[model samples]
Target: MKENGIYGLIAEFEEPDQVLAAARQARAAGYRRVEAYTPYLVEDLAEELGMHNTGVPLICLLCGITGGLGGYGMEYFAAAIHYPINVGGRPLHSWPAFIPITFELTVLFAALGTVIGMLILNGLPRPHHPVFETPFFEQRNQSHFYLCIEAKDPLFDRTITQEFLLKQKPAHVWEVLA
Candidate 1:
């Protein structure tokens, strides 16, 4: 354990199975604030962490609806109320003509919502994090798998958490400092 402030205790594993097992054990032991890092996606990892649901779909839906309405509203006001011009003898509020712009705006807003919502939800734009303080953490980009139990967890105790992590038989364990 670190003499100073601690962010968490991270266990390094050589295989995805080890990380998965450690995460499962941590959860079973009533540790809620846990996270894992790996070079690639591990099947069932998110389920083990209980992190399935996300709000991105709902955000995209609402944004797409708003964009469609705004697009139609803009065209309606411009062609019918603001500048009334009978082009090609069509009706002032031509539904077919509005379809193209509305569709485009719906797609654009949905894409934007996906990007913005992901950034916001994932807490992006963070150039650095305390987890980087762990030794050999940079190796996560290669073959290593990591499981971290945060100090902020309600059930966290330095000695007990470290002992629990040790029972998982990790290759290395380190105290992540803030």
Candidate 2:
């Protein structure tokens, strides 16, 4: 059993289907802290890995709404209340004039929120990950599929997890070092 902080077991498979199957089995066996890496997106993989309920979309929506409201409010305050500028005999609170800015701000905030939300959700900007300690992890971006069960899982133990991974018939099962 590895005694490192990142003491986790990784199972390497030749095909994405095998990884998906192993993930389903892991989820069924009550493993909550499991993640799979694949070269390309796999349909139903998120559900199999129990990662379906992400909140990024909701966050993006809220941010877009906030941005649209903020832009509209700023325009209202500047043109109508604070510094009323009636140009070309137009009304101070012209809705048509504010539409373009409001739309632009909504798109800008939605895009920004999506990017930041994804980064935050995925725990990004982590230049170095404990999984990098494994030699075979580099194959993740190529042909192999990997499923890692983190030590943070309540049912995690290096020896038992390694045994379980081996039973899944992976080509290689290694312990990640922190």
Candidate 3:
């Protein structure tokens, strides 16, 4: 079914291998934008689906470095340049003094970035998803394996896509409602 520019197709598999095989077939058939849900991780599914590496970790790293540098810069500016407080003959730029706060900020930013990046990447805080409308999908966290091909696929058409999914020989295939 299609709604709000999102199209859903449901395919069920009796075993993980079947799901993986279906994913491979879908990939060979030029279906790229698809998602699979399973109770457990499937080793070859990601590769079979041609899902590429994500940049969330890289974003977290960059944000962490920025936080560290920002912390250090703030300390440098406050103790060395902006205020220039020389207490008890201590150096204006106390590298050791900046270590604690810099480390703390680095970790804090990295953690915050990781969380925010993950939420953003995952489209989280979503109270509802079209996939949930599939009655069989409740077993997604149990024993079933499901693959959904979104309507956004350039080559997607309900009839042809359903035919292709059936060719995969899934145990049961149902339409994912929009």
lDDT of 3 by residue, 1-178 (tens): 3445445788988789988988888888998778888888889787788866767889889989989999999999999888997699999997998999999999999999989998998899999888888875775547899988888777778888989999898877777756
Per-model TM-score, in order, reads 0.92, 0.92, 0.88
* Residue 132, candidate 1: alpha-carbon lDDT: 80
lDDT of 2 by residue, 28-120 (tens): 888988988888898899899887778889989999999999999999999999999769999999999799999999999999998999999
Runs of candidate 1 with Cα error greater than 4 angstroms are: 1-4
Return the lDDT, model 2, position 162. 80
What TM-score would candidate 1 get against the native? 0.92
lDDT value for model 1: 0.90
Q: Sorted by lDDT, highest first, which candidate order results?
A: 1, 2, 3
Candidate 1 on 1-178: residue-level lDDT in tens?
3234889889999999999999999999999999998889999997898788778899999999989999999999999999999888999999897999999999999899889998999999899999888887785647899999998888888999999999999998899987
lDDT of each: 0.90, 0.87, 0.84
